[model samples]
Target: MNRIACALAASFLFASAAHAQDWRNHQERAQDRHEVRQDKRELRDDRRDVAELEAVLANFDRARSRGKEREMVAVESQLRQLLKQELVEGRAELAQDHAEIRRDNREVRSEQWDSRHGGDRRDLRDDRQDRRDDIRDARVEAASQSARKNIARELSSLMGSRRPRDLQRTRTLIIDLIQLARKEVRDTKQEAREDRRELREDRREARDNRW
Candidate 1:
């Protein structure tokens, strides 16, 4: 019967379409798995690159031979440039991630702000701990200077003394005072360094936040 043949043909066409759809779904699934594997591979490669960079930075300055030192310097310069580029790229990625997070948060907050007061306001807070640290550093610097002056005076007095025992005692006292002054100076220097580090970190955070 022609009707039976037509029905059979329609069923065959439908079956072919189903088979093609199944094949396409399988291909899509395989493609998704391949993409995931590739992402993992890239992530591992990036981690290895970072480790290599750190090793180069750690050992780049250790060569002692004249020729080797020059070589080391050249290598270190190149490594530094490479690391700088990597760091810049990493920073840009992090900043982009931060910007995306901020944008999402802003959208959430905007809805709430609009509901509350019809004016959407975003708050941006500036960190001033660095300024406070700078003030503390100035005070420590002044104290270190005073201690250095006292140490100098003690050393001068020690140099002028005549009696052997007195001289030895003066010398010992001067040495102790000098050590104390040096310690104070070192402490002040460390505080200043820490403050500078904190300021740099804050600036970096600010830059990252800007986007």
Candidate 2:
């Protein structure tokens, strides 16, 4: 009975560990998606700025070709201002995009690291909890086994003097407890295995999406 309880506890711990890792991966992927969207938006804006600068330069050239000196001077001034402003804004936007890209790259690397290493501080926390559960389950199992042994010993001592029916009933009860414990342990183990499998598949999907 005690062994069964210990097995069930171990199964639960395993499931929890897998779940924590899966959740971390999900969050990392979400962040990656947001970064990608922002990068695309910035690129679109940069393209629009470049198009406007080209149009302004074209107008300045047409004014010069028409021999309109005053108009050409005005257009040239406007062109210079537009060029300077665009250059400044473009450089700033480009710098921001570069920085954002670098940040995104770092985030991807961190996510990959977690996928390979079983995920950040959460895994550490889960490991600690598993260790504590192991110790507690072990102690409980030991105590349960000891108590069962003591009960069996007392029953054996009274076996000759006690009614046959009473002895048989006590034996049956112990057997039933053992069976129940085994079933519970088996079910828990099956559930843990399923959870682990799902976690593996999820990690794979996340990796593919990132690439």
The candidate that wins on TM-score is: 2
The backbone clash count of each candidate, in order, is: 0, 0
RMSD of 1: 22.0
lDDT score at residue 113, model 2, on the 0-100 scale: 54
Off by over 4 Å in 2: 1-20, 101-211
**lDDT for every model?**
0.45, 0.49
* Model 2 Cα lDDT, one tens digit per residue, 1-211: 9999999999997677566556656864564455445445544554554455455446545654575667655654554464355445444534544554454455445555565655544433433433343344334444444444454455445433334465455445434334433432443343334334434544665565355
Residues 53-117, model 1: lDDT tens digits: 44543443343223364655554455445434444444443443344344335434433543354
What pairs collide in candidate 2? none
Lowest-lDDT window of 10 residues in candidate 1? 118-127
Error of 2 at 18 (Å): 4.2
Q: How large is the C-alpha RMSD of every model relative to the true structure?
A: 22.0, 38.6
